[model samples]
Target: MSESYDVSYPGVRVWCRDESGSSSLVVWRSQWTPEVIRIETPTIYNRTVWTVGQARVLRDVLDAAVRCAGGGSW
Candidate 1:
C-alpha cells in the first residue's frame, strides 16, 4: 500500500505523500504534474508548494464538492 493523501475532483485525481511535519506545508499534484509520482517513492521524494491562499481555495472547492455529493464531514 502507498502512504499518501488523495482526493478526486470532477475529472481529476490529486495526491501527495505525507512527508512534512509542518501544519502549513501541503504539497499536492495532479495529472498535470506527473513528476510528483515519477520521482517520489517510499524512501525519496519531492514537493511542490501551494500558497496559503491557494490551499484555502482548494479547501473551499473540496468542501463544495462534498456538499454537492450529498454532504460529508470535512
Candidate 2:
C-alpha cells in the first residue's frame, strides 16, 4: 500500500509505501533554472535528479495514488 502527502512548499510532494512489510519514504521537489526533479529516499539516504518530463511521470503516479486513497486536499 502507499500514501502521499503535500509539502508546505509549492510543487513539492512526499509519499511512503509498504511492500512485503518494508516501508520507504520518498520526496519530490521541483527545482528552478534548468528545471529538474529532486528525489530523496530517506530509508536509504539516497537522492536522485530527474528531468521535468520524468518528474511529471512520477507526479502522475503520485496523483493516482492520492486518488486511490479516496482523494484529499493534500
Tell me each candidate's RMSD, in Å, in order. 13.5, 6.2
Give the TM-scores of the predictions, in the order they appear.
0.37, 0.51
Best by lDDT: 2
Worst 10 residues of 1 by lDDT: 34-43
Residue range 1-74, candidate 1, lDDT tens digits: 43445532222233444565322223345566433322122333434345556667766997798889897643
Pairs of colliding residues, candidate 1? none
Candidate 1 residue-wise lDDT at 31: 63
**Which regions in candidate 2 have their CA more than 4 angstroms from the true location?**
1-33
Backbone clashes (count) for model 1: 0
